[model samples]
Target: MAEPTMRALLRRRDLGLRLVSEEDALPADALDRPLRWVHSSDLADPTPFLSEDLALLTTGTQFDGLDGADGYTGYVQRLSGRGVLGLGFGTEVHRSGIPDELVSACAASGMPLFEVPYRTPFIAVARAHSEAIAAEAYARRSWALDTQRALALAALRPRGLDATLAELGRRLGVWAGMFDATGALQSSHPQEAIAPEVLALLGDRVIDVLTRGLEAGQSLAIGAHPFMLFTVGRGGQLRGVIALAIDALDPEARTVVTSVIAMAGLALEQSEQLARSRRRLHTQLLSSLQTDDPALARRVLGSIPPAPVVVAVAADAPVGPLSDWWERLRAEGGAASFVAESPEGVVMCVSADDEGLLDQAAERFGIRIGISEPESYSAFSRAHSQALAALRQESSGAYRYADTVGASILSALATDEARLVAESRLAPLRDHDTSTGADLERSLRTWLEHDARAEPAAAALGVHRHTLRSRIAQAGALLAMDLSTFPARAEAWTLLQTARD
Candidate 1:
């Protein structure tokens, strides 16, 4: 249904209205212009009271005092220029019939003129228009309520947004499409009907929408087609955009579009909420695994891969693509693969045999990965250390597996325990050096580094072999450690590594 237009009002012949202008003067298309309200003003300059698309009725009371054709012509021209739908001249109150000058002026200016006989009061036309307007408004309200109900039902369907958008497009008799904030097309109905030009138009408008921060709906032209765009959210949030192809949207169609925007915005919000919840869970699980809390990690993740797990850490990796990698890992490694995002990079624990899988992924995604040797769940912390060590050694942007035996001793203690052991064992030496400014600990460290070779140890210390040996003997005496024993040498080396770890 259409709004109350001039053509619709003119069809009511009960008031006996007559068109005084040339029959062809009123264009058929112009008759459909919407009529806001019926207004009657006798003031010569009633432009202030009148607005566009209104039919102005007059009695010529003010015109009776004016001079000849110029006054009447100027009067008609003023009404026409003010964009009134038409001028209604009421006869017998002031004039007997329509003035010839006014008729000619109306024709020249393309303004439709009508005559109201003595029997027909200006109030009669106003009353008829008022009733027609009320009827149209009622019809529109009824249509709007019906459309809203239909949209609500569509939104509740099992398919959710897809069915809702399809229903909208069906109702509007056009193709409808939705796009997320990333300019990715989420969905579209009757995909074949989505012309390339329409997508291009939306692309162009997106730039404008982002730059100008447009939150309201915008009606644009795509070639000869009409396109209506509405932001799915408010306050510049831009949850998404809904676009439909239609020449002109009536009140009923606009009502449907608005309902779609509301539902779509709600759906988008819910989707984001779910994603955030999953991300929080993933982060929690990652924290537990990274902190070497295997029990907590298993509890948080709900399950753990079977023993001999291969842990890997990546450096400078893109987090956005990690989600995709996780899903891919689940496909390839099934229940044996697990991935999580860490602050430094992404971390993963897969079956030891899946080392080749990590290598393939790193190559495919152009990322560097560091893999640990086969280790049980009890050694997850050790595996992480190996992975980190391997990561530090990586410089070729390729995956590197940890040298199991070379770093195995360091992995025996988790990072924190190693730090404690190093601090406790080296405490006496550290305190003595702090007070006396001695090089006893440094000398022992140099000797151990050179495999107890006095010549190299002396060269490394920049001292004579005798002096180096003397410092070592002094360090052993101060700590009550036997420097000549294998157990003592091993303990010293382990302490040295912990201090560095």
Candidate 2:
């Protein structure tokens, strides 16, 4: 399916073309240059009307009455400068043979010179090249059809997406990679074909396009490596991107790529639908487990996570990506795990021994997770409540129920409403201290910390007991509360504990 070249034309027995210039005079790849077309002109300057990569056939009429080699040299220079592949001389029609000066000029300029005998018309050469072009085009079309059929059959395999991508890479003789909606590398043909740095660059470009939510293709080169990236699925709902390591594709090759893109998009859409149904089933199974009936859930899932399992709840997590992660784990025969969408966010039940999976998920997705204590399926509801309580704690990354045990009551009361009430209740003491330039609020908190005692509180504050007592009394007066009463002291302690710094 390659274009015809000068060497190919010279091999045509019917054309009877002969290379007049010495082989050494031509550039190494001169004869191998692809000939786009064959044109004949008798004008003194045909450079303006000619294009690159084509042969210009003409009789030696322009050389008539020419004296020196200057005219011939300029003529050859013009044709070469215009990117004309070669010059063909039609002998006998003008002066029985190519002029010696013209041949010398062509040799000096490295212009490929060939002879067109009187018996062979210029039309014959053009027609032969045109026929070759048509034959090449037809062959390409046929190859495209056959490759499309092969890709379709590949899509019907067990691992349709992977199989189709592999087939595409094989057919195109290049590397192919598939990224998921989260911009994670899902699959790649010839898995390690791309270097890590190149892959990182590709990932960044893919993320940029995905963030824009566009259905488009981009051609880029990282150093000497070239890549063609295309977004799969529709705009604003893109499933992923497919990257091919190639500089450019012909029209027929583009048709093949387009077909693969459509197939990949369809496959990913169907995967999304199947994931939704699977999540629904997981949610129902989780609900069944909450009812203290593990048997029904176990029957459906073959087996649940072992008795000592911890339930994790993550708010605003990407359920699709997490589900895909769990699916991969299952495929690898890792510990049994279940993921589902809940009112809180995404919920997962995994073995306590495999809690590291939760850490991995959190790190991979940049999400915070709350994990409960290890408990049996019989207490699944309680475990879920514990995880929810842990989720409410002021923490980042993975917050566990165990980490909350014996923690500060302030952590539990760390909410907007509680902070507002605390600020309001302690405002009088704060304002009074600020106005008087006294440390009454500090003394009061110190006294509370000392179990409402005076001597130790004074020692802790580096002040006399009488001084501490006096500050406490002043604080009580400003707050309009009796400092000696249990209710007043308890209320002050609670307010101080709940207020933020």
Candidate 3:
């Protein structure tokens, strides 16, 4: 806050510069202007080289050959227009004393004029002002460094992001909020001060910021609040944004804000690194579960449950916060519950008792879940298939448990088992064929294929209609199972198809 101003520089007694303008002419407010630099330009037109808020020093040599006071007045007018803090005139070289024309012009134009004594060199004043500016800059930088360290420490605490944002809001004396890559609000301090519209605006602008690579801090207004948007990232790769409702136009304040931005970037990187590590672990666990080696799967899972395990699959839903789902499952299944990604969507492995948690997650995230029957670790592959089948059958907003009986049960059976079941159901015909060299199995398949129509079945079989009917009757008698009911026919048909598949 202690900046180098024109009045402060003039109060230094070492330079021996005298105030030439009247006390009434130079108001206290005029001396309070912040001095950017001390420039010594003897040129008549130094406006091109000069910038605003600078103290300009000269020897009055530019006006020596001019005839009238207009030249001197014109020089003063140009200096005033260029925002010169004040004019320092050396009296020894160009004339005997300060020129009356220049003094009258300074008074008339209301430009502060001071006389630089013959003993003091312009270089000395320039060095003094430069040193003062450097000191103020160093002070601000040191303060900013301390603040950054404090913020980093705060970020290490429990609920760290919230703590860090709270500390930042307190430091900047404004509402501060942090957002994730998805523009989800992660944390905020003085939360009530942030209007809902401001968060919406933040979400809207983050897309533009990311797409256009607007990584720099931008000042924008949202409803009643003037917000400062800082994209948090490194090397032009954005991870998140930090919004502050503070007027950070001051150079020192901006430096502090820059430090905060850097901290936010580091925090985001750390969080993302942790997430990547977790994902890698989850993928490894999923791979182990899918492998044929039960030993390796057991090793990866750390333990095998005495109770049967069920796998629940939730696919093609509007993906919600993964952390919420994970926490929900852990709440029911303890730490042993695993949530991971599947080719279809997200997959969860939990005990049968905790399978219902998948229903809660599906309902909350607007997804449909499929729960597989309880199975051991060795049958995880089968359970996964069952869950996928259940998920495929679900046509509404609720979860569906994989059926363990009837035609739906065929989906969970291995190809070999399906073939065995199909052959066993028609074993009597096969045994009879072995003894008598008959084709009743083929005849039965043909009859079922033609929907029990004797004419079409006989034509497809290249046999007489009476012969096909006699073969079908013989097979039904040999099998000793009812073939008239829909359920019996459907079961036979499903088993046969399972065998073919």
Candidate 4:
């Protein structure tokens, strides 16, 4: 935090800082250290974009040679009023020794003015300031590395998702929530509802950092608040996202977050690969059983024994920290994956093969999980569907196939029957019929997506406004629901979601 003094600045100047009036008000201690870009605009008011930290290097050129009857006094007054740190008045070009009126105006306004003798170029000052700031930043980074190591070694309970997120939030001194690429909460600290603003900010960053097929990590500052980000990768494709926030965190805290994010990313990628392999095996085993040949099914099962698996999916994700929570979930269970997404909430694909895996994950605070019924290797697809259905119902209890009649029986209590019914009833609105159009449902969605702006939606869809109006009218008539209504909108949304599924 050693700031550059006026003496240091003067030394950096090629002609050396000469004492003209010998009445320099700013002490050597008060000169700009890390000055933001130098400004010498001749505009009467350059305050449109210049911030407070700017070192305004004007040459009295804006006065138009005192074109106004008030002399250059008014011009000086305006610059000082704009919160400029100091003024550099060019002396040689317009020499009559800077108008006494201008000097008096600056002094009275409490603005520091420096005489820029004709010999000195403003570029020199800009270059010197840049170097000073760069050096200071480098020192901070070096200190940051050491602090990071110390933070990593801090003792904490060996728990799962909740513990991980809580630890990070505590260390960073900020409320932290982990999101999957689709922006679902993987794990959160000070876990309250997240604001749309926060989500939007992180979401934009995630898209920027991750490639369609690649997953990686990055960091950014939003409104001056620092955040660390990571990518979820699997099967040679990016899976989800992770983000952590640290506002005014210490150097040590920042380093610790960086390390945690990196470690988390590695863990998530590994678990995802494991999940994919298990899923592939499960599919192959089940396919053999479905082939109507018992012996072939046996051979398939013998080739790849059915084992348990776990699932996790991308929720409302952005370029926030993804790796941390995924890793924690893995430690709690045998494996994890970005399962799938739906409006109800994020679903995780967990390989709960062994006994007591759910309890183990819960004990570690791994993730909020609802397990499905278990079956042998020959029913991978069926097992996966049951698990997903159970999750969709948002059941609090762990469901087992054995708990029901048999593997063929899907646990009726495991799913949200009411929601399913509602969606099913609205199926027509979500589906496409030849009488309507190839993508009638999609067209309806696009129309609604633009906030019901008929003209804009029609233009974007390459349709006439009248056509869009007629389609909406026809959809309303067929569904027997006016989608412009709030309740109707919700129903329509559910319909669209079911169709997408």
lDDT of 3 by residue, 1-501 (tens): 568987777887999878888858776667788899999978999999989999999998788688889998898999999999789988786677888999999988777888888888999989989989999889887877777787888878986777888888887788888876555666788888876876787778865776576787888876667888888875456777888887555675677667777777777677667766665676677777876345764666576434488887777753334543464335566645666775777777777776666666676566777778888887888888778777766365444554535544555553566678777876777789889998887888888999988999999999999999888778778877577767777776776666652
- Stretches > 4 Å off in candidate 2: 21-28, 65-67, 104-110, 184-214, 221-225, 291-293, 389-396, 401-406, 427-443, 449-471, 477-482, 485-487
Q: State the lDDT of candidate 2 residue by residue for 1-501, as single tens digits.
A: 666899988889999999998987689999998789999998889988988999999997888888999999999999999998889999998788888988999999999899999999999999998998888899989989999999999999999989999999999999999988777788898998889889988898888888899787899998889999888988667899999999899899899999999999999989999999999999988888888778988898797788799999998798987888888788779978888888988999999899888988888787889999999988999899888888887677788999888988667766779889989988988987888899988999999999999999999999999998889998899888897999999888888888876
Error of 4 at 156 (Å): 12
My TM-score estimates for the predictions, one after another, are: 0.58, 0.85, 0.53, 0.36
Give the C-alpha miss distance for residue 255 in model 1, angstroms. 5.8
How much lDDT does each candidate structure score?
0.76, 0.89, 0.76, 0.56
Q: Model 4: runs farther than 4 Å from truth?
A: 1-34, 37-54, 57-85, 88-100, 103-132, 147-176, 181-183, 189-230, 234-236, 244-262, 276-501
Candidate 2 vs 3: which has more lDDT: 2
What ranking emerges by lDDT with the best candidate at the front? 2, 1, 3, 4
> Per-residue error at 493 for model 4, in Å?
42
lDDT of 1 by residue, 211-232 (tens): 4667877888877777777887
Q: Which candidate gets the maximum TM-score versus the true structure?
A: 2
RMSD of each: 8.7, 3.6, 10.6, 18.6
Local accuracy of candidate 4 as per-residue lDDT tens digits, 397-452 = 34443344442323343235645765676567555455554555666788878877
